[model samples]
Target chain A: MTTLTETRVDEMSFTSPKPKRRIPWGSIVSAILLSLGAVVMIAPFMWIIQAAFGETARAFVLPPRWLPANPSLENFESVFEQVPYGMFMFNSVKIAVIVTLGQLITCSTAAYAFARLEFRGKNVLFMLLISALMIPGQVTLVPLFIVMRQLGLYNTHAALILPALINPFGVFLLRQFFMTIPKDLEDAARVDGANVFTIYWRIILPLSGPILTTLAILTFVTMWNSYFLPLIMINDPELQVLTVGLTLLRGQYGAGALGPIAAALAMAIVPVLVVFLMLQKYIIKSIVSTGIKG
Target chain B: MSEQIMTVRSLKRREAMAAYAFILPTLLGFLVFVVGPMLASFALSLFDWNLLTPPEYVGLANWEKLFSDARVGGIYVNTLRLSLMVVFSNMTFGLLFAILLDSKLPVLIRNFFRISYFFPYVVSAVAVSLIWTFLFNRDLGPLNYYLGLLGVDSRINWLNSSQWSPLAIVIADVWKNVGFYILVFLGGMQAISRDFYEAAEVDGANTWQKFRNITLPLLSPTILFLLVISIIGALQIFEQPQILTSGGPGDATRTIVLYIYEQGFKFFDMGYAATLAISLFAIILVLTIIQFRLSRRWVFYQ
Candidate 1:
């Protein structure tokens, strides 16, 4: 009688048994599927890196070897010897840096005015700026190429640097970032007799480190990888940046030096990889912050 | 109040000056580079000018040639087909993969996959094209080797077939770029509130039902944005086709941009090229307008 009473008591405490801790089937399946995807996505890059240090003929071997036994830096040596590799690297670095700096200053100034200053036609002007963003870069390429030719900037680093420096994306992105700051900070600066220029330079600019970092990375990557503008603007072989340089290298290899090209490709990725590693935090932040607005 | 008004007026003038100063570089650059060239391309389009000689005004001849040019239609069709295939497939798969990634998984594993997918977006186009070329090679390529193992004919010239040529190009293009759209979709998915899912779960809704009722509605705006931008971008497709095929085995893969590049640079037919540019510009504009108009019926924003 006592045992029967205890069983009834246990039954009373138990409502519906929590659904047998459902096998985390979803997580396991997704993990497996995504891992496969990761492999597929990363394979080509790996292949290229292998091919870069690979022998021209052997690089094309069926069953594709993931590891090259005789990986050498000869391809890199050839890239330096056969082409203006150093000059190209220097051009890319110099142009990207100067353009990034130029964008930071010019875009920040314009963004500050749009975000803070109240002026007549401010809305209209800002609208025009934003609308310009929709105009495809290709539409402007031919005209810009001609303009560069006329200005004697054709086949020069300036042609690459100048057009990129005045990016609408930079202006727009910086303005959005600047708007996030509380107005009270600027007002406080103003009441302290800070001029608009002084306020922007001293207070507003300093507070915008993260966004500025984001913009810097964006501008750097865009300019660094840009091909068409440089293709049209720079005709001289020596003036070629890495994109054109790589193209030239591809042509020179003529289907034989896959390993060297792969190695060269691996070399090509170093700057981008460096930049990515350095500012990955800001990159994620910028992308995430934009999603909230969306 | 009077003193504030005076300060406001001075500030307005100061702001105007600052606007000019701030916009000076951009406007000057725009005028010199973009606006100035746009006018020039228009004027150049009316002229029979090679780089070697002064431009001779040829009126409607360039446009006339463009309409009747045997190759023009082929180029247009190739470009349109490629763009449509890429835009549709990229969006479809990008959304699917994003959904998969957003499912409950280990944080480290998920982020690793996310970064891996995004790797292609950062790599050079030339490298990607070269890599695909090797993979698609008939005799030595892994693709044929696999086909042979499956008892299928291994002699297929993947990039040589006029019909399959465009498909091959499209596949490569999609593989390289789907990650970018995936990132966009993932961002959209994360923005959706968990409460919606919780509510659905409480209602005994299945995953598909929850996705249809809740996820798709919330994600539509991002989808619309991606759709329009992708359409616009795909229309100007150049690098991959240019490098991989050079429009291949005849003009099978020649895109409008490639056509323009050929006309403007290779043949130095600036007028003809400019005419091609204007046509491309019109098509892109129309597509964008259509997307904007269509957004009203489908796109849901909260």
Candidate 2:
């Protein structure tokens, strides 16, 4: 009755047709428009890759080279030689990994409590947590900067890592996932005299694999690409992450160095794209589920 | 019975303690990072304070300056105009793409195009900005390169010209973000039930009629959600303008966020910056509330 692919799009909510009919002209028109849209959407990226491989900064010369005339690895080579690109990558990976782990643990626990465990003021507290979503991070930047400065956290990775570990959306996402699980299992665990922590660690966490992994990916990508916070907090060149470091290459290296900068840019973009490709389904599901419900 | 009651009370208290333990990290984080800063920001906005020196009690002086500042008005208008353009194009095209991809086309063909479209979203903003910066180059940029092929004689340095800088920012930002919006729209499209379409088909409803009567009504909620978010996100446009344009070309690309950044970081006018931030925050808050109120009328949950 079911297959893996079928389960993948459980929300498709459409049934297969019995026989083929004439090509829907209306659908065809829409498809052409969509394909055109896809082209427009994707062209910039294609152009970037093309330009990155060009032998010179003259890649942008009129009758703009759509395809690289003499593609070379010179840019890639120079990217490594000129800047501490590797160090920036390491910092990004380090911050992303630690922040992802922290958020997974913290948000899971909080979500479990809100979804299953009832306490005095639970509704009010959960509201407080979700309400944070409405407020933009820009609103917090100035004050957070002051607080971080007071705590001697300016120009430090802790400023970036710590704040990221407590995102409200993760908690909300995990809670929604938790609510969908059957309650009978929790009751059984309670009857066995398992404490809340034990029940959560063993029963709840095991069942929440899909949502947890989803949260992890979202957290990792978001933290990895975070620019503004890193921009404001870590001013020291040494403390800069991938985005900040890459930005410096543009300003300092000048237009002549476009090849190397483009190479580095390609390198910076590749990892996230790789991760996205691997987990496209989960990412799509996570966003769709949360956004539609909200 | 009395003994059992006492045991149950003890159990409830123990459960409460566990709940607190589980929630402590996130709660404390909220208080420290979110609530604390919000209060501090409000206070900072009232006083003429730079980090290096003690703050003077300026009262509403910063707020007053924000209202009187010509630069503030200019930034607001530019940001608003750019936001509207982004929101319009993103939603209009995103929904259309979702509907097309949801057709009976080969799954591989559909998915390949979808992936191709989304390829740009995963790239870093800095990277996208760099790529576009090259394209917007006056002499060597491919935009002019292509325009040259079209028989246009004069070449415009898109980002260097006041009239074009803001438009350039919009084009760059939309290119980077359109994929994410497409995915959002596609997700919503897939979630619609087949029964409605089937019913419409049986009733001799053509594609247009079916879409107008069934799909459009059902998809309104998703559209509304996207619209509100787009409006909010568009209003806060920063990175593209900051990186690509540097809010330049005579400040034509200066958004509200950029203005705040210039004041706070570059000029060290934290007080004035806070005032700008508060103004920005209030506008966003009002817009969000208005959207939320309006949703009840048109955002069909079912």
Candidate 3:
């Protein structure tokens, strides 16, 4: 069963278990090097935390204090006071939730149809959708903004949420996953008198826990971290997502207001960070799947 | 016989209808947001409209202006430089990180390094830019501060200077995106069977030789895949530079999309923005075609 978790690694020519009789210099070196790289990768988060709580609020500081001289929650407090940080997070969460949920529903159904159903123009329609995967969102940015204006979705979360609901990548990913499902299962369901929709909801979805989880986590991450859409679609602070709000905060507080912006950055990053930490396995699995097939 | 055929045809039609019903939501959205807007973007490129006045047909005037605009050249140059720098740096570091992560470590430790490295990639660009802005602080920026410890006389400001701003943004862009490449490379690495290494070892192949002859050859497909994606994505890079330098110190960090945003929204040159958008699309499309054409020579798939 080529479930999404299947790594699809080919028959290796190098699987001999090395005799670790000596110092194992290679492993040690790799471990040390990897740790250092991870530190560099993670150093920014540490700085963000320290700066969020640091007493120093300037943009340019010499002999930068990696450890804070005096740590405080003042920056976090000020972030809330200065901008509606809470509202931005809430708005972001709301839109992300809707988009993720909507994508799961719409994309799953479409993927199921694409993968399993036989229709006259199935190949043609699938080709159309796949061709769109290459088209950059910026190609349609100005026109999309105008269309949003025409639909009265301008400055509304719908502008962010609606376009997000039908991502080609999401559809493509799920369709690929669905195509991997065995025909025997559907045959079994038909033998039990389950209709197409019933089989989809009951058997397919339930059986697709791994791929669905992968899709959900990925969709949420993309939606949460999305910047360009919200930056363009909504102008109001109340409606703007966290990414756009933090940017606007830069404009408002100036780059010099480092402490509060870090605090805001910390706040903005927490939700997605939490999800990532909790569901990282699925996330990694999704990437592996995409890498092999992409 | 005719009635029986009609019954079967009607049943097939019912199945097709059910399929369409399932796909309708996505199809409608694709029409409205993706396809329709793309068509409209093309149309808008032909005319001058500021969203207030009725669109006046300029008949290729916008395209003419796009080619003639001096800033367009500068913008493309800056964009190409940034994209090439970021994509190359990200791929190299990503391959390094992937190699490290793929080595024989405790599975838990490997997972930790893998997850932590990708933390920045998951964070929003605005937030990443914010954190980096603090880290880039001239007086107390951690980077210069570290350099100071190395006795490098380290008072450096990256954001404001036109000379350094592009590289600064490139660093942050690489940081933001390198995690993705690492994931891709690691995935590609994992997909390579250990049999190749075993064969290489039997042949007494050195580490670099094994990697080049076996691993690198096999990994070319992934590299080629990433080449396409990273370049296409690099072309549309807007948010990072926008937040980092705001095209700073005089158009130094201004990428193509950033320029598009400026033209369409800030300058209300919607037609010009649309033209740039189409130009950007054409460039990406042409480049993608070229990459595919060239891939056959280098990319190896098993």
Supply DockQ values for each candidate: 0.45, 0.45, 0.54
On lDDT, the stronger of 1 and 2 is: 2
What ranges in model 3 sit over 4 Å off? A1-28, A56-62, A291-294, B1-6
Write model 2 residue lDDT over B1-302, tens digit each, in one string: 99999999989999898999899999999999987887778898889878888988899888888889988888899889888988888777677677777778888887787777766666667777888887788877767776788788548778888878877887887777776777787777778888988988899999789888877888888788888888888888778888888889777888888888889988888888877887888899899999989988877766
Candidate 3, residues B31-129, lDDT tens digits: the string is 999999899988999899998998899989999999899989998999999889888998899898888787777888877887888777777777778
Q: Give the distance in Å from residue A193's predicted Cα in candidate 1 to where it truly belongs.
A: 1.9
Residues A43-142 of candidate 2: C-alpha lDDT, one tens digit per residue: 6666767767888556555565667888887777777777788888999899989999999999999999999887898999999989888777887787
**Winner of 1 and 2 under DockQ:** 2
Tens-place lDDT per residue, model 1, A7-43, is 9878867865656677887777877777778877877
Candidates 1 and 3, the one with greater lDDT? 3
Give me the TM-scores for chain A across all models, comma-separated. 0.87, 0.84, 0.86
lDDT of 3 by residue, A241-282 (tens): 888889788877877788888888877776678877887777
Q: lDDT for model 2, please.
A: 0.81
**Candidate 1: which pairs clash?**
A51-A259, A52-A259, A52-A262, A52-A263, A54-A259, A143-B37
True contacts kept of 2: 0.60
